[model samples]
Target: MSDLVIGLGGLAMMFALMVFRMPVGMAMLAAGYFGTVLISGARSANALLVTETFSAASNYSLTVIPLFILMGNIASVAGFSSRLYEAAFAWVGFLRGGLASASIIGCAAFAAVSGSSVATAVTIGKVALPEMKRFRYSDALATGAIAAGGTLGFLIPPSTGFVLYAILTEESIGQLFMAGILPGLLLTALFMAAVALVTLKDPEAGPRGEWVSISMRMRALMRALPLVTVIIVSIGGIYLGVFTPVEAAGIGAGLVILMAIGMRKLDWRMLQQAVSDTVGTTAMLYLIVIGASVLNPFLALTHVPAMLGEAMTSAGLGPYGVLLLIIIAYLVLGMFMDGLAMLVVTIPIFFPIITGLGFDPIWFGVVAVIVIEMGMITPPVGLNVFVVKSVAQDVPMATIFRGVIPFWVAMAVCLLAVIVFPQIALTIPSAMFR
Candidate 1:
């Protein structure tokens, strides 16, 4: 078969496996192994598997993934996420839709320490859902807010996504982490604003509550001092060259664990659970990734992406038009796929074309992350939606999905801002480096 036909066939097979509920990693691994054997014969495919798996697993970059994952797990056991939410709530829980708004802020804070969207969603859902429910917050609003807020986990600093993106794109993790701050805040603000506005327009979604005293707010902030210190020290360390991203993850993880122990929130069982959970979660992510490594070579062998890139350029779409198309594609894909799986399947093809188009790598990285953030809250297979749905089981799955709509809108706007201004995403990296 022609390479395009072969490529298309392989892609179809992979998706079919996904539809069959095969793990993404297993599906990709199977498709890649078979596709390679079909196109290039057994011996060549055998060598490809050994070498690709080795290279993929052996890289220094991939080490960052498990470390970040481990750190999040440790922090989760430390009960740091609860404190973060309570801190945000004490300040924002008084306004219209403020409970929901507080959830978003809490998610952002948790993301600084917890890099996984699912972890952030589940953790925040546990802490904020009960409080929001007690206040008679709409099921849709409460559940949706947590799902949407959960996405901030992957976009904020110490994000595994950002770290992986830097590794794949060869951008500086420190700078990419730094570049993320403004855009991260921009996305969070957009989410909160959407929550407030939607609740304002539909008062039933959020009931009004009394504002708290300044003393209370200040005390609440003090309660989350460990998180604040971790953020400052880890981010400050990375940006200031005092530590690499990996080293910073260690520091953050250790500090959060120590604080949790100090607070007496963590028991021996919780600590064990943390380690076990981290290992399981990390294993799942790695499986899909290893599968991608095998599949990626096959995808390249087919040359479909390169051919498509050429065709896009030839169609008079220009670089920007193609970029627009890519963004739209990501938005659509985000609805159906896990963010990392989507990234693994797509970035190899997109990265070359993006760099070839002369777009700034740092800027595109931020934009891609925002797009992925959109995916985390999207339906069918959105991790964040599932996270919230699992925690708030009484709230129907559909309601949780619907609730994410406004935040998705906010995400869309944030995405556009990144696209149009570019500077909002790039200025920090550019300034710091130059």
Candidate 2:
């Protein structure tokens, strides 16, 4: 078969492997290995594999991945997530769907400090799910809120996915990080709006809890100051060019350790767990990076992405048409593949097309981050939902899925807004650079 045909064939076989329940990283490796061999035979494939494995595993640019992840894990161990929830809940819990809203806010705060959707979902689920349930929130609303809220991890400043994308595309990490800020806030607001609307309509969906006095709110806020400081320093330091992204991760991680020690949250075991968890997650990401390096050069040999770019450019599809096509494809794929796997696989091919279409690389990065965020809450492969389900075993999976429906709808609107208003994605980065 020709290279194009072989590449297409590999994609088909990848879908087949996924449908058969193979793990994602293994599936990608198997398909990538076989695909390269099919296109250029075993001798070439072997050479390609050895080179990619070394380049991927040994990459200095990639070191930032593990450090950022380590920073996030250390922050989690320090127990800032619960503190965020408590503060947000105290201020908002009296409103209808307040706890659910707090769950969204809490998750957003966690996203600021952590990079993993699963961690955000699991952490917030443990803290807020029961309170939402005790207040007689419907299982759908409660579980769905937490599940959908967790997607913020992908678009927020500290996001692992964003950092990975920045590395892959050779964009300025600080610019991309700043670019995401506005869209992230907009998406978070939309989620809160969704929860409030649901509560307002049913009133029964979210019971109004006792209102906190100003003193109580002040106490709650004080508890969250350290978390606020961490976020401000880490993100602000990078965006303002005071430090590199890697340096910011180091500073944040060290400060988190200090704070955790002061808060009495970290001990020997917790610290060990943080390091171990960071290592494991980092290893998994590098493995995918390895697979991508192997797979991408082989894909590059195929010229399919370039060919598609030529066709689209020649056909006069314009930017809007291409944008629509990308979004539609992501929505469809989210139902079948893990969001990160989908991102890693498709982005290599699509990034070129997107950049060639006259969009700013930083702007496109923000847009892709939003799409990936939606994918995190999307089903079958909705990793966040699975995380919440694992934590709230008593809540039926179906209920969690059902509750996320409106939030998903809200996300759709938010996506449309970003697509229509490029400024929403570009403004922060531009302002920062200016």
Candidate 3:
């Protein structure tokens, strides 16, 4: 058997393992290892596994993952997420569908601290869903807004999506983070527009919230300042070149811990929980990185990415056509696979193809993230939708999925805008680095 056939078999086995409920990291590791043994010897596979595991675990840049996760966990335990929603509510809750809009704004704000989409959805959903229900907002719009908005956690600065992409592609983390900013904001705005259109069509779906006094709004904003300040200082420090991404993460985590303690919110138990959660999440991410590292070598030996690239380029599809096809594949794969798993699996194959077509890697990172974000709210395997359902248990799964439709459409628009005008993702990064 040919090395290419072995590689294809390995890919199939990995997906089959995933489908059978095996953890994605393990599945990839198993596939990569056994596949290597098929081509090389057991000694070579063993050596590859040991070396890659150490390399992935000891990589200095990966420290950013835990620090940022710790910062987010500390913020959540300290009730900063609730305060964020309160502040957003004060500012926008009076407009039609304002509560839903506030949820989106709050998610965007919380996403600055939390890089995980599931965490963002759960954190904001717990705070906003009850209030929207009290205000008689439609279940569909309320839940959908939270589900869709949570994806910002991956697209905003301080994003794990960008971090993983950087690790895989060896791009500048700062540039990818900067590239995400305008697109994140643009998507947020588009989501808000979706809410407006929904409320406009049926005022009864989203009733107008009572206006807040200016003083009250100011107070709420002040109460939410800790997280906002942390986001500005940590993320802003990177853009200003005052801190590397790792330094920014460390400072962000430390500042959040101090702020929580200052507010008397981080008791010993709460602190333990935050640390425990961060460790668990960090370990999982490390495993995935290791798996990808091991698998990449095996795939390289098979020359699969090279073969795929040649086939794609020779198929007479122009760059845009290939891009569109890639996006469609992502959409379908996303419906069945976890976002991070999909990223690690596909980037190795597709990155070469995309860059070979002369597209900017930084811009492609943003575009890829946005498309993955859409999958988070897509049907059947929509991770964020399930997260929302978990929060609003009484709301049917169908209802939550139904609600995300408009926001999903908004995300498509954002994706297209970024595609047509690459500067949407490039401008901030360019100006910053220049």
Tell me each candidate's TM-score.
0.96, 0.95, 0.99
In model 1, what are the clashing residue pairs, if there are any? none
Q: What is the per-residue lDDT of model 2 for residues 1-434, given as tens digits with 9 covering 90 to 100?
A: 68898877877877788789876666677778898888788998899888878977887767767777776787777778898999999999998888999999999988888877877888888899889878888888999999888888888877877777876677777887787788889989999999888987888988887799999999999999998898899999987889887788888888888888987989999899999998889888887777767767767887877887787667767888888888888888887677778778888878998887887778778777777777777777777888888888988778878888899998888888887898998887888888
Model 3 — TM-score against the truth? 0.99
Candidate 2 displacement at residue 83 in angstroms: 0.5
| Candidates ranked by TM-score | 3, 1, 2
The TM-score between candidate 1 and the true structure equals 0.96
Error of 3 at 156 (Å): 0.3
Candidate ranking (lDDT, best to worst): 3, 1, 2
lDDT agreement with native, every candidate: 0.84, 0.83, 0.95
> Model 1 over residues 1-434: C-alpha lDDT tens digits?
78778888999999899888899899999899999999999999899888877876787766666776766777777777777887888888888888898888998988887777888888888989999899999999999889988888788887778776775566788888888989999989898899878887899889865688999889889988877898889888887779888788888778878887888988999889988888888788777667888888898899988987887778888889989989999989988888987887888789888899999888888889889988888877778888787888888888888888888899999988999899998887777778
**Which residue pairs show collisions in model 3?**
none
RMSD of 3: 0.7
Clashing pairs in 2: none
lDDT of 3 by residue, 182-225 (tens): 99999999999999999999998899898999999999999999
